[model samples]
Target: MSSKINAALGREIRDSLREMRIQLSTLNHRVGSRLGLKDADLDCLDLINRAGPISPGALARRAGLHPATVTGILDRLERGGWVARERDPADRRAVVVRPVQERAADVLHLYAGMNRGIARICADYDEAELRVVADFLRRTAEAGRQATEEL
Candidate 1:
């Protein structure tokens, strides 16, 4: 009886996880479109948010975009007033691009919810088990990124 119940719960969890991922992805597409972001804008922002105060050329390289494309994205971002470019004080010829707000407050709220939700899901796991799960996910993501590079 106990074994059957556990197996059923496991299946439920797996299906629910898949459904939630799909829902979140669809929601992201909808919300991003509403916000006037291109399908690729999220990746561009993520790259900039991770390593900003950098130049358009460098941002293009890191985001796997052409320099001209990066310039276009930057122009849109600047027009939206979400980003700013300033001449590097040291070089006076170099430009720095940075987010106007570091992890915007609304964005932080969403992060908090996501963090708590994931923590709650893993609350049953011990630290060692959690470590293994985290490592596995990281490795899986790395494999995915590598596969993209190969294409």
Candidate 2:
């Protein structure tokens, strides 16, 4: 493809990705509200679950939240039975946050429709095409993380 065409495609893809992110965030807010949790709390739970038993400080750093704010988020999550704080084995004085497995499925239920759609779309791609799509998504996700860090 010509460089001009490639550049235009890139711009279009970036804009679409931005809009998709905004829509996803809006969906998450609605789901969070339905679950009786703030969007930030669900975001915190997601970060904690992905990290798999992370230090409060580390979670706060990744979430771009203050320690005090993280504390409040954790408090609410714990009270809702969505997460728990366990003393870090490596550092007895420190606590690590983890998701409650039972409640995790409830969160996943909110994304079931999207997940099914994504799976159906992926079914149209062969192995090689799927690999390309996966690679593109991984690189795009990294770019998003970099952009978030910059902000």
Index of the highest-TM-score prediction = 2
Model 2: runs farther than 4 Å from truth? none
Cα-lDDT of candidate 2: 0.92
How many backbone clashes are present in model 1? 0
Report the C-alpha lDDT of model 1 over 1-151, residue by residue, as the tens digit: 6999999987996797689779777766765576677756656765777788888888887777889898888888788766789998778989988877843553445446567888898998999999998997788668767877887
TM-score of each: 0.69, 0.94
Looking at model 1, residue 19 earns an lDDT score of 91
Candidate 2 lDDT over residue span 1-151, tens digit each: 9999999999999899999899899989988988999999989999988997999999999989999999999999999999989999998998988889999888899888889989999999999999999999999889888999999
The whole-model lDDT of each prediction reads 0.76, 0.92
